[model samples]
Target: MGQANNKTVLLPLAFALGLAGLAFLPAVHGNPKTFAAFLGVSAALSAWDALLFVSTRRGGRTLSVDVALKKQHYLQACVQGSLMAYWGYYWPPVYAFAPFILAQLVFAYAFDMLLVWSRRDVYTLGFAPFPVVVSINLFLWFKPDWFYLQFLIVALGLAAKELIRWNRDGRRTHIFNPSSFPLAVVSVFLLAAGKSDITWGQSIATTQFYPPNMYLVLFLLGMPGQFLFGVTTMTMSAVVSTYVFGRLYFAATGIYFFYDSYIPISVFLGMHLLFNDPATSPRTELGRIIYGSLYGLSAVWLYQLLGSAGMPTFYDKLLQVPLLNLSAKWIDRVAGQWFTLGRSLTARQRNLAYMSIWAVIFAGMSATQGVGDSHPGQWLPFWRQACEDGRAYACPYLADLETSFCDRGSGWACNEAGLLHIALSRSGEDLRRADPAGAAVPLRRGCELGFATACQNLNTLTSGTGSFARAQPTIEDLPIILRGSKGEIRERDPSALYALACHEGWPDTCGRSPLTANSLP
Candidate 1:
């Protein structure tokens, strides 16, 4: 009976792991290296499970399926549905990946069911995995060739809720959040291994802005969760704190600190989705405020920290969640001890009050161009000027944005990027490998694309002639807005944006430096 129980427990996990691995063979069969990794993971899981079976002893354990309708999860499903409706409509990749998403749902439920059954006869299951899978997908996905990792990601999240448990009150609960735990773990491994290219980590961070009114969509879709879960305080504190910190950073530096919007759409999503898990977040109202505030401030700090390390900045939202989850109990305890958190109002009333304040602040952000569908910082031209103004961070970002435009067949963008590298050389900033010859690569591409000035500049450099004059960027020479997925998108929002810039009439206010300190910190 004892040995049989061990088999029951380990066998299902091994089975689930094997099936999940095999499911990816078709997706990865074209590449030998990727296929080898997939097979290796499968073999490792099998061998580990067999070893556990041989070495471990266990008495027969009773199991039962515990069924409870968690309103928080199902309601989150409704919210995710609304988010998917709009996001999927805008980026059809949402639809393209629908089958895999559906497969994972099956895998999560099956894996959770089997894993639970291994220890006990009763397994409580519902839509618990829905939000976990969807949230992780929104934040990160392995590119198509490496899509097999997606299965492991989903499985890890599901298993976290089952395996990593701690005592709370009279019962047990998972210490880390299901979705965040896996994402944070994977983020660290990727960062340490310096292997972020295999995943769409960067693209997901940027392309989240592809949908229209994404900020507004996030706000509206988040309302039900806020109202029902009484997490409004957490959301309010997070948003306000991030906004406050961003304003202060702006005060110190001429740059808009986030380098995009006052609050980037992806980070905004993190504020709402990543850290606001009701179960994982703090319990007391004051604790929730502390939790949210810390998340907001930490996100800002991590953005700077990650950038300086030359790693992906998308990890800013992810890295702090598990830490917060672990500290939640202590935060509540500290709040109860040190602060006067006596409540005169009911939890519902308190949540509504917080939501009302958030509404006003959000409106203010929208009106003042703090965040919206469009912003001055989103313009490539603004960053180009900043790059030329000798901002080290701006050069790499400018090169990236300009490369996107160049990929869309914009010869002028190619020329602009080449010139920016030349400018970088002059300023003694060597962010991009510090190579002066890097200028010729883009310049040659622009010349081939039939841009007369690019051809002239390339000829001037390669023909042993003296350096050519760097062309000054003007309205005519620049691509006004980055549009499509590849920066080929054309849209009319630029009209209103520029009209506002021209109206502000600040010195050089062609939407470049509209507000903030005139000097860097």
Candidate 2:
């Protein structure tokens, strides 16, 4: 390929990735359109790079060979990559795009190099694109129909890094975190234009909790970066602030404001990984404390704001970093001028003290069920009540939970989801989205799946009957632990038809736990 001594050979690796991507396509799990667009973009980029090099005689001989690499970039990339792999163990949607995500790494490299070299003579390449591309993929991705937009988001971020600048500590620095700037900007558009469905933002937020002990997984993955970079203060402060705020909120309202935890898994993820970028974040310890506090407090505020506005709250973490980045210099200047008590201690010592405090707090939080696998909010009873109470995210979450169960062939869940959908459609209070017709889909499926209640509900919905005419789903009972096959279970009480029924998914019979199987001892 370089027989003519071509300066830009159009990365062979890009073509290699296109071949690899077919393996992850629809048969296994990805949207085919998205992969096609990605592959096409890869081809176009290679063609353009080769054309530029051949014609202009100006394109650099090597892509980023002359650029100095930074430790934090690759370190952050590894951490983010490990996280996605672990989470993918419990979720296919996250894993289905392995090749596509890798393609972004190539895109970021060639496109970033192309953008730079097209403007100037010498281009310095490093691992700058690694963290940026990987981080964006970690949080949100586009639907296949709108897959091209994902490229736009990536382009905006990469370009903004080069175009947007401010003088910080005598060097021309980016005003906003490269990845975060595009996220916040795009979020504003999504919220304002009512187009959030184009991306998988909310699905990512919910599915993130699917992995067992995910909170701990994230904490462990985040520690190396914290240890190496001395960014513990920011993470620690953010955690403490959010934990305290959530505790106080629960104390006042008797409900967890963040829903499933004192701190939500995804938001906690943001605290650890997303907003703690040392380069764009506050440099001084005091400034970091304030910056982290604001991030935490603003997350709470933004969650409420977005929720109240009927927008997805996954944006809460994203919308703040850009704003915080804009303020970081001011914060450093102000806090540096104000706080001088730490002058006696070495920077390393202060960082150690911060890490020590954070470790203690994290331990306490884990020990106290503040950010772990088990929480009361995870139960159906809590969601059932919250849905009735019109908590902004509650009905949708409850509906999603039941719908997932329905998809798994649980007729009881289908019935439950149909009821919730009907209620949501009729109420018209929160999102004002009425999917009355969509309610029949689940009810009909439930009936076909052998849940009698769902059959009755389907009849009610299809027969043009009124709203919720049948029954509301009850979480007062959970499925009892039946320990045998249908035949063995029936053999326990050979005459008991109800035994057969319970084993066959009769909610009324299966609902009674063995502990309460009989009231009279």
Number of the top-ranking candidate, with lDDT as the measure: 2
After best superposition, candidate 1 residue 143: deviation in angstroms? 2.8
- On a 0 to 1 TM-score scale, where does candidate 2 land against the true structure? 0.77
Candidate 1: how many backbone clashes?
Answer: 9
- Writing each residue's lDDT as its tens digit, candidate 2 over 192-252 gives 9999999898888877887778888887887778767878888888888999998998777
297-346 in candidate 1: lDDT tens per residue? 89888998998898889999999999999999999888877655437887
Q: In model 2, state the lDDT of residue 311.
A: 77
User: How much lDDT does each candidate structure score?
Assistant: 0.72, 0.73
| Highest TM-score scorer | 1
Instruction: Give the residue spans of candidate 1 off by over 4 A.
Output: 1-66, 338-342, 387-392, 466-488, 491-521
User: Model 1, residue 400: displacement in angstroms?
Assistant: 3.9
Give the Cα RMSD of candidate 1.
6.6
Error of 1 at 268 (Å): 0.9
